[model samples]
Target: MAALMLQGTGSDVGKSVLVAGLCRAFANRGLSVRPFKPQNMSNNAAVTADGGEIGRAQATQAIACRVEPSVDMNPVLLKPQGDRTSQLIVRGRVRGTLAAARWREGRAGLLVDVLDSFERLSAGCDLVVVEGAGSPAEINLRDGDIANMGFARAADIPVILVGDIDRGGVIASLVGTRAVIDPADAAMIHGFLINKFRGDPALFDDGYRAIEARSGWRGYGVVPWLADAGRLPSEDAVILERSAMSTGRRVTIACPITPRIANFDDLDPLRLEPGVSLLMIPPGTAIPDVDMIILAGSKATIPDLAFVRAEGWDIDIRAHHRRGKPVLGLCGGYQMLGRSIADPHGIEGPAGTVEGLGLLDIDTILTATKTLERVEGIAGGARFAGYEMHMGETHGAGLAQPVGHRADGSPEGAISADGLVAGSYVHGLLALAEQRAVWLARIGVDAVGPDHGASIDAALDAIAATLERHLDLDAMLALAQRAGHAATNG
Candidate 1:
């Protein structure tokens, strides 16, 4: 099977976005393509079509490939549980928690599972585009590493390094990587790609050639900052860039960013609304003036819950609700909006109960079983498609008035008696055109913006067009599959 892998000089060097763009670019050429990541560490996750969970980036890549996401796409997933320990997910199921120190000692065996998943995804595909985690330059983590060079060596996949030029010193980052890594590992990388370039490319021509001269690697053209990249959902990092809600918008919405926030991409559609001005309130800040406030999902709910109270956001939310402005929560945030949250089994953390924001007349209990599914529902009288990913069950007076119904006609979410407060386990409710319009209308906006899904498709196509125009697609494709380097041991 033919495959190519993109390994970064460092994290956030646009490796995930580049792999996603190439996946779409190749798929658009009528070639069957699949996206793979051996390991991913992020609280942002996507529930697979088969009722499993993987990194959100893989799911975005799956959308680019026009296929349903599967656990095979991301073999080992790591969800940070606040402390040094992480909850390990293998092939979509929880494998229990592992501390940073203990996980390193046992990860070599996990490579077998990683490769098995890659083998399955590689079957019957024209090409498989793989993404490496963090950077392979850290020789300290090289022994049992299944994320970067080790995975490439195990799978015999060709590697192309990527570096962010916008961050400056692209030449050093690329050349420095070659200088530090083992000779065998360095030999595996055939070329390098410079990403996030802005202004004149000719200004860096000497630096570009210098990278090739020092590293003995070919240059794969520079990629300017993608203009349409904002339309796509970011996978790993939380959106920290905050500004005032744009003036003259009919509705004002505030979404507070928690310390361990997860799946905040659910708010992407709202940012696209012309009549909606969305503000991302940072931690340790009071909720600002707005017609609506949405509490986003959190990886560590109890701790984040305590954090919210410590920041006095609980008072801010209650004040917002008292003014008759709406308050909404998703997943973990949904658990925090109820009367109380009980972790009797200590599924998330210590076994105890915490007082909630008390917006909804409901109580929740954390359990070991997690619900993962993609379903359609009705919200504010509009049919919508969304997904459920949570591990809590709620029961109280709020259940008497559900916010919507599932595709299978089961009730979901809850709406307050005064219609000013609600909480739901469903995510991506505003992504669809109808639901977005319904939400806008509820907040007194008369109009809705363009279709979110179409906008994303257009953005993906624009990225592919950029690749076909600026990058050497054929040469990169060859580099992806070509591998002929003698290596020394790490």
Candidate 2:
């Protein structure tokens, strides 16, 4: 199989988005394409069709390729849980937790599993586009690295280094990478590309050439800043820091950005609504008076609940609830809205009980077993489809008034006596137009937004078109073909 890998000069350098675009661009040519990430560290995850979880970006890429997401797409997922520890997932299922001390050796041992997934995925695809995590320039981490040059060498795939020109120092970043990496590793990078270039591409002609001359690698193309990318789901939490509140919308919805936030993309659909203004309230800032407050998913419910109280967001939420404004919680947020949370197995931390925000008449207990599945159900008299990926269980009088019903006729989530507070384990409910419309009506905005799934498809097409225009597709195809031949022959 023909394969090309995209490695970035640093994190958030647009490697994921570029790979997704290339996947779509190649798929448009009627070629079978697949996306592969040997390892990824993210909290925003998607439940795959195989009943497992992977980073959300891979799921988006699968959609771009017009395929269902599989655990093979992202074989190794590291979900950070604070205190220098991460929940390690191998081939979709949780293996255990990896601490900072064991990070190197722990990941090194997973190379076999990663390659197995790669080989399996390659068997069914004509071309595979691989995305590297972080940079190869960190020589200290090069010892047991499986996410960059190590994987590239193991798979014998050609690489194209990407630099974010929008962040400046593009010339230095690309050249600097070549300057620091091992000679054998450097040889794998056949070319480089400038990403997120603002303004006219012509203005950076000299800088682009300078990188080529200094790094001794050919230039692929200079990609302009993509406006459509904002319409897609983001994998990194760093974006939350840079997120700004949208203005001029009729209804304001506030979401407090908690530490270890996971699957916060639940708010993405609301952002599309013309009448809804979604504001991500960062720490040290007070939660503003908004029509609704949504407590998003969290990786560590107990710790994040502490963070919420420490940041005085708990006070803000209470005041908002007293004002009769709606408050919704999803997954961990749902657990946090209960009366108390018990952790007997130290699943998240030291195995203790903690008081919740008490917005609803419910109590929760963290469990080792995790639920991962796609589901469809009825909520607010509208049919909705989404997935459930969460741990623990909640029960109380609130269960009598569920926010919705699962297709199996079981209660799905909790609703307050006053009907102003609700919590659900299901994510992506608002992505459906009917469900979004129902939520919008609660805030007195009767407008229905565009179909979110269709909008995402259109955004993917727009990005593919942009890449087709700005990137050298023929050259990339040639590189991938050459690498494929070499891998097969060896």
Give the clash count for model 1: 1
Judging by TM-score against the true structure, name the best candidate. 2
Over 1-490, each residue of candidate 1 has an lDDT whose tens digit, in order, gives 5788899988888888888899999999898899999999998898887889999889889888988888999999998877888989999888988899989999988999999999899886878999999999988999999999999988788889999998888888999999999999997898998999898888889998999899999998999888788788876654455356688877788988777888888888887888888888886678877888999998888888998998888889999888878888988888898999999998777899999988888999888888888989776788888788887788999988988888788888888889888888887877888887876676788546666778788888899889887789999777554532222121
* lDDT (tens digit, per residue) of candidate 2 on 106-167: 67888999999999999999999999999999889998889999999988999999999888
Top lDDT model: 2
List the pairs of residues colliding in candidate 2.
none
> Relative to the unseen true structure, what is the C-alpha lDDT of residue 141 in candidate 1, on a scale of 0 to 100?
93
At residue 44, what lDDT does model 1 achieve?
A: 83
Candidate 2 residue spans exceeding 4 A from truth: none
Candidate 2 at 388: error in angstroms?
0.9
Every model's TM-score: 0.96, 0.99
